[model samples]
Target: MASAAEQLAANMNFQAFAKATELHKRIWFTLIAMVVYRLGCFIPIPGIDIAAFSQAFQGQAGGILGMFNMFSGGAVERMAVFALNVMPYISASIIVQLLGSIYPPWEKLRKEGGEAGRKQLNQYTRYLTVVLALFQSFGIAVSLSSSPGIVDNPGPFFIISTVVILTGGTMFLMWLGEQITSRGVGNGVSLIIFAGIVAVLPRYVIQAFELTRTGGMNGGVLFMIVVLAVAVTVAIVFMERSQRRLLVQYPKRQVGNRMFGGDTSFLPLKINTSGVIPPIFASSLLLLPATVMGFAASGNLPAWAESWLPGMVGQLQHGQPLFMVLYGALIVFFCFFYTSVVFNPEDTAENLRKYGGFLPGIRPGKRTAEYLDYVLTRLTVIGAAYIAAVCLLPEALIGFAGVQFYLGGTSILIVVSVTMDTVTQIQSHLLAHQYEGLIKKSKLRGGRGR
Candidate 1:
């Protein structure tokens, strides 16, 4: 039998949506924000020769540049203002979060302090974003200048301008994302990325068809790719939704003449508590090598150094054994690292003990914490393997088929996860709207009875 909430959700229709005026506003705001983001992807920064840059980019397109372009919705390909995207912000956030776990001051602020502390940490993240953006944009500027004819003026002026424009563009995107999170539906940063990936999806699909028409790819391979994509997506959804429920019991107690407590509940822990962070962090680290090599290739290096750079880049190329091994290892490492950062079994156990709750077969406090940790460790191991498999499969397909579709495993994960989350938020709003209508009806009935 369907629960009341489930039945109510099933019965929801256009009428309820039409009544959700706030949801409409949020949806509109999100659309407009995404439009603005897409527009920025085309707004090229000053001092770049488009033709020369395009030619140079084509050579490096199969490497890090290609991945970044996919994430930025072709912003990097166009040498647009948003070419940097929100990567600097993401890097800064990761650093801050890692510090919050190990650094004493940050740890205290994160746990002991509340909203104000969160705001402070956000400010710190923004400041660090500016620094990283400046550094990365400067390096990119130098790299562009090194490429023959890529920069109109290969001087200090051009470099400064590129750095400033790119940095400013990134900061603007960060601000835009914050606004969307506050005033619209879904996570601002993630939605920005989501919008970027989805915008380019149609073009990739068309490219696949074009490849088939030109006999560039075998038809059977394409079919297999499609099937594999579907299978992986299904697996992602299932694993993401899977959780372990731990039963907790509260002993009956008496307060005054009334009985209280004596409740039974289950504490739900997701199999993949780290979500997409592990894969994102892993990819970012793996891609860093390509970016570094680009800078080195552009520089005047010794003969030995020049010879070694090519081999290093080749070894780190997508689908190579070394690349896959490192990618999977990093994913596994981050899975456990991030899971520990986000969830403290000791804290949870302490909270449960304070509330007079205990696990069915385990004592409260230390024993409970140990039990939770043991279960979580096992789940993380499984989750790490799942994430590694999903992410690496696309790399293998790309290598085997010699087709470059930007909708890789990471892209699919982000798209599906964000879409699910947004849909859930919409349903919650619709449920709230129904509850409000019920309250109004009940109030009128009570007044009539009086």
Candidate 2:
């Protein structure tokens, strides 16, 4: 059966896509939406001095704000309307997920309710996104104006205009992402980040070339960086595809005097059950202090606050020992946290038992749940370590080499993971089309062992 499927996939062509009009439409729509999003990133917000803001960001590179600016595709540096990007939405979604795990009402809504409940939760998340966006926008506006010569006229009008424009931009980006998810080929949020990373790649490469030209960086080190990037990409691909297969056996049953259900299947558990989220969450948390400090540093705050805060913030800078350790710990913590939120071994066990399925070596109830949990825990540990290494290593290397390139492990992971997911979806579509072709051919042949 697998070989047949593989053959079918091999035979798939543009003809299949031509027949799949709906999927084609979706793919086109998604592309168009993404193009629009990229255009929006270039649209500068009104009433901000672009040159001054850019200069401020230059001084603040290696700080948290620069990281945020990178994620937003330089919108933050340009102080574009979409400076907030979809970060507020992501933050709100995380908050809702965390709350759903702890809050009974939200938990019940997640489990007992159906589409209606989901819609309600989504509405709530959107509302929260708007709130977060507004707050962040206000903070950002104040931060920018605090910078000397950033705002020519720092007053209520400038603040209000900036806040409104940023808020609107964020909501627009959020809407664009949702549209892509519903009408496009891949995840909208991920694609946005992928686009941002890809956009920045050329700049990083150029910077590396400049450094080498100036004799600031060794050619050997540049070669090593390239080789290391390729190696990390390969490793990420391997780890992301690695899985633990849990063997399940079904007892034979009589159906209309014929034996059935005596089949076995393996439940595949991914090594990294929580993909990308751990590092993203960890980075956001670790960078929070630096972000605040960056803003505060722009302000004429109390002497004690400025003195003590920047020093503390320096400790959390990208290559600092404290920063790496805390970042790795947070990645591990969120790996476990997000995995538990997304997967419930108890629920899986119950569903399997209800379907007359049992693990090969475990009892069908509590024991199976315990077994699954144990397996997941071990897998999560490995997954967390993989994430930590992939994420922390790049920063450490860049820091040790004293290179100014901006590419990092987290960016590479997102790019690779999203690319793989997109390819898998495309393959699935092709396989389905191939199956449809087989069915049509068999119908034409009319039995007799085609």
Candidate 3:
């Protein structure tokens, strides 16, 4: 049976994908959804003065807003209705996940119920997104209006309008993401972000050339950067795919009258089980305060407040020592935090014991749980360090290289991880299709032989 399955997979080809009508439809639907997302990013919000807003962003592009703008695919810079993107939703989801670890009610909901609980949690996340979106939009609007020469006049009406519009835009984006997830191939949120990042590539390239023309960057540095980027991308791919396999042995057991069971399997744990969450969480937390500070600096504030606040803000700015330290620490913290949230050794051990599975050299209950936990702790440390290096090294290099582009660690990790997952899904679909074809062929051959 295994040999036949292998033969089926070996024969799988592009023609199978073409013949699979449902897969084709799914692919097309995903493409259309992405196009819709891109279109939303181009639609400007009602209140913003485009010319003035553009100028303001141009100056503040090196700040926290710059990072946000990149994530939104230049929507923030263009003052688009979807300028906030789905980040508030992501932030809300992360917050809920974190809280679920500590809060008993949330923890119970997570462990006890299945689909119903998940749906309830999702509903809560959406509510949190709406609230966060409103707050952030209000803050952004107030800040934009406060910026000198950016707005014609600042008033309660304008602030209220901006907040409402931005919040509505975010909700719309959230809905769009859900549609993509239900109908599309990859994750809707990640694809939206991926689209945004890809959209700005041409601009980043153009800017790089402009820098070269202006002698801001030399050809040697440019070559080095390209090489490093490629190498880092390769490393990300490798680490993301790497896994540790824990061998599990099942003892023979008699059920009714027959013997059923001496079998072996393996528990696979990914090296970077947390994926891109750690870096993203770290970035969001680090950027929040800097964003607030940048906005405050735009406003007319007391001199004393401005003097002290700017120093505090400066510490959190990208490329600064304090920023790097905080970012690294946050990444490590989230690595462990997210890992624990996702993987429970006790639960795993329980499931294994229920299935009559045990680690080759370990006992089946508490000892098995403890062994798994010990291994996971060591693995988490390695995973955290790997994440930190991948994320921080690029930023450090980009800082030293003085590149004008905003390619950061989080963006690269997302692109790599999502791409890998999508590819694996595609391959699995193809393999299944191939096996079905093989089974049909084998049946036909058997009938002829009879």
Candidate 4:
């Protein structure tokens, strides 16, 4: 049987959506912002030779450059102004967070400075973003200048111009993301990436169909691909929603003349406590050097960069042994590190103690904290393996199937997680709207009875 709230939610219809004025505005704003972003993807940067860039894109489409192009909504292929996207911001954010964990002063500021501290940290991230963009843009500019026919006029002037244009584009995207988050709905940065990935999905579907029609792809093969994709999506949805709930009991209490307090509840510790953040952070880190190298050398490595250690960035190629090992390692590392950053067992334990709540059969404070940490560590191990497997399998398929699709493991996670989050927000808005209407009706009835 469904609960009353569940029943009410199910009963909601399009009429209720129409009545939700605020939600309507948010939806429109989000749509408009995304449109604006997509438009920028078509606007070329000042000095790119579009013909040469297009040709170059075809050869390097399977490399890291292809991944960048996918995330940029094909902006990189066009050498569009928004080609850099908000990747620098993401990379900078990762660096800042890593620093916060390791550096005492930064950690103290985050722990003690409250909301103001967070603002300060954001400011630091923006500064770092600019620095990173400058370096990356310069690398890209130089790489383009060195490559024949890639740059319209290969010189200092063109290099300077490219750097300035690319850096400014990334900064603009950063601001636009903040705007969407504050004025619209869902996470702005993730939505931007989501939009980029989804925009090219139709083309992939068409490509698959064309191959089938031409007898290049067998009908059975196409069906298998569809089945695999659906199965992966279902698995992702299940993993994203799975949680480990610990029972928490509050003691019965009497307050003066009234009786109160004996209620049991659950403290839901998610299987993936960091949500989609770990993959995004790990991808950003892995891609940072790859992006620089792609633009700096365009897959033809200089001797210095080619000197191989185990898992060198220059040696990275999807489905290769070194690439798979490095990718899995980074995913696991970020999963544990990010989970620790976002959730503290100690803090949870302290909060529970303050509220007179305790886990069943466990003592409060230190012992509870220890138990929570133990459970979380075990969960994290499972979560890390799950994320790595999900991510690696798709990339491996790229090499095995010989398909040119760019629906990466990380991209799928972001798209699904963001969609789920946005849908939840919309549902919450609708439920709130229904409650407001009921209140107004009750007030009118009371006035008539008066």
Best by lDDT: 1
Q: How many residue pairs clash in each candidate?
A: 0, 0, 0, 0
Residue 138 alpha-carbon offset, candidate 4, angstroms: 1.0
Clashing pairs in 4: none
In terms of TM-score, which candidate is stronger, 1 or 2?
1
Which residue pairs clash within candidate 3?
A: none
Tens-place lDDT per residue, model 2, 1-450, is 577977877777888867876777877887788778778888987777788878877877775556676777777777777788888888888888888888999989988777877888899999999998898888887876666787888878888998999999889888888887777877888788777777777877888888999998999889988888999999999999999998899999998979998889999999999988887777666555667766675567796697677677677666778778887898999999999978999999999999999998799999999999999999999999999999889879977987766678888898899889877877787688678878988888886565
| Angstrom error at residue 95, model 2 | 1.0
lDDT of 1 by residue, 1-450 (tens): 996778778878999899899989999999999999999999898888888888877767777567778888989889999998998888888889889989999989988878988889899999999999999899888888877778877989989999999999999999999998889988898899888889887888888888888998889978987898899889999998999999999999999999999999899999999888787777666665678786587568888898788777776766667777888898899999999988999999999999999998898889999999999999999998898889889988887777755457878888888887788888988998887887899999999999
Q: Candidate 3's residue-wise lDDT over 376-442, tens digit each? A: 9988898999889877886787778777666666677777888887777677767777767778999
- What C-alpha lDDT values do all the predictions have? 0.86, 0.83, 0.82, 0.83
Q: Could you tell me which residue pairs clash in candidate 2?
A: none
Q: How far is candidate 3 from the true structure (C-alpha RMSD, Å)?
A: 2.4
TM-score ranking of the models: 1, 2, 3, 4
In model 1, the clashing pairs are none
For model 2 the local lDDT of residue 270 reads 99
The TM-score values for the models, in the order shown, are 0.95, 0.94, 0.93, 0.92
